[model samples]
Target chain A: MGKKIVLTSGKGGVGKTTVTANLGIALSMLSKKVALVDGDIGLNNLDVVMMVENKIVYDIGDIAEGRCRTKQALIQDDCFPSLFTLPSAKTMDNSRIPPRVFVSIVNELNQDFDYVLIDCPAGIDEGFHRAVAGADEALVVTTPHISAVRDADKVVSLLSTYCMKAVGLVVNRLKGNLVTEGATMDAPDIAKLLRVPLKGAIPEDEEINLSSQISKCKDKSSARLAYLLLASYVDGKDTKVFDCASDYRGFFKKLQRVFR
Target chain B: MLKNNTILRLKRILLSDKVNMPSGLIQLLKKDLLKLFDSYFDIKEESLKIEIDSNADGEYDVSIKGVSERIKSPRFMR
Candidate 1:
């Protein structure tokens, strides 16, 4: 059976959905069959991030309520045929799918894919528990900001009670310039503070933001490379993360930073 | 300096009761403690205090203290 992992953040807008979509594609590119599940039932957006919003005929709610089969709810990706997405219902009603049902759905997906990535909703409420109930491992995503870090810490503390196989941290939107200037904590420091293993550090990139909002693809970027490394790390490979502060040091680089 | 200050502030915030335990949970704990203490002595509900302090190892130290008016009449062995 495949491993089921949940991508979660205690605070919103930390790139959980974006990481889920891109990392799913990245893992698929690595010749792994990956399935992305939009666990944010009320505020579903993973379908949009994967650019498969128009193709979702049945959602997770249908599968949970026995309205349709699991295969009917899954949308196969066009670019990466090995990747599939199970989008959440667009309406807000937490009672439709209990935590145990969500667990069963993900367990069913585990039989087929190599990795099942669940894009969890923001905050530590019912939605968070529902998403986490099915996962064998968890990836807590947070930005470098103090608020986000603190929230991630609380989440780590809570996850300890669940006895998950593994819980790692992904520092998203890390500002390389700020880290270089000593204005903020970097990925390692943030991970250390939270007392969780660092899975990946995704730098703040405009290309990532643009690709998440629009259905446009871009060439190789720092965030994409970081996600590739993260995928490998999740696949049980010891990979060295690419440096995010490489472009903010030295004389010529300082000039380039000032220009951009 | 900003990074250090943020780390320090975050440490303080994490130790706060708002993050460690919600107000509702604290209230329930207080109620349960009051009931347990009432069986032994007269507990002052208004004076009952629940404190969560941080130890050197960054672990929580919960203290529940109260001033009892008097001990309840002993009838356990009767």
Candidate 2:
């Protein structure tokens, strides 16, 4: 069976959906058959990020409700035929969909795809519970602030109850320049604080927001490089994920490095 | 009766920490606790003052009292 990995975060607006989209694209780039499931039921946007929102007719709820077959719901990406997305129900209430239904949907996807990445809704409510229900693995995304880190820590603690086979951290919106200026915590520090292994660290990039709206990120900056490295890791290829802090070298830091 | 260990764990914990309890445990407490709490207290749009004190028997006694007066401050919720 393919690995069912849920991408989730406790805090909202931490780019959980964006990370899911980029990872889906990166994994597809490596010639892996990937399926992106939008687990955010009421506020589903993974299709929009994947640029398949226009093609969605039968949503996940329809499949679970037995109104449509899984094949009818799967929207194939034109850019990457290997990448498929199962859109979430836009009008359905999150509490209405049972965990067993979501699990069964993912199990079916696992038979065909190499990777099933579930984009979870923000906050640890019924939506969060439903998202991780079918997953053997999870990546908790968080920013490098105290509130976000605290929320991520709570998520890591809650993942124990679901009993995932593997769990890791993805620090998003990491500003290396701010870390160098002692304004924000570095990815490693945040990972250590959360007590989860760092799977990925994506830097703050306007390109990410811009590209996902237009298309998935194609530029070779810190954000894209980090995601590609993450994809390589997920592909079981031995690769080091990029450190966002390495890009920043201020005048004082340069002088300090010179002195050292 | 709530154990001392349970109270100790509850101390200084955030809402996210306490809210994610097992469904079985929540169901076990909800029905009994909700009915019991409803008899004595009603939720009002005001801050509550709670006090906990240890008696001579070394058991914690918890009390809850609603604030009668409302604050007309701009930062009432904050």
Which prediction has the highest lDDT against the true structure? 1
Q: What does candidate 2's lDDT look like per residue over A1-260, in tens digits?
A: 78999999899989899889888888988899999999999899998888888998899989988899998999999998999999999999776689988998899999999999999999988888988998999999998666677788789989999889889888888887777666667777667555688888888887876776213454555677888888888777944777786766767756753564
In terms of TM-score, how similar is model 1 to the real structure?
A: 0.80
lDDT (Cα, 0-100) at A67 in candidate 1 = 91
| Model 1 docking tier (incorrect/acceptable/medium/high) | medium
lDDT for predicted candidate 1 compared with the true structure: 0.84
TM-score of chain A of each: 0.94, 0.92
Q: Which candidate wins on TM-score?
A: 1
lDDT of 1 by residue, A68-167 (tens): 9998999998878999999999984887899999999999999999999999999999999999999989999999888888789889988988889999
In model 2, what is the error at residue A26, expressed in angstroms? 0.6
Clashing pairs in 2: none
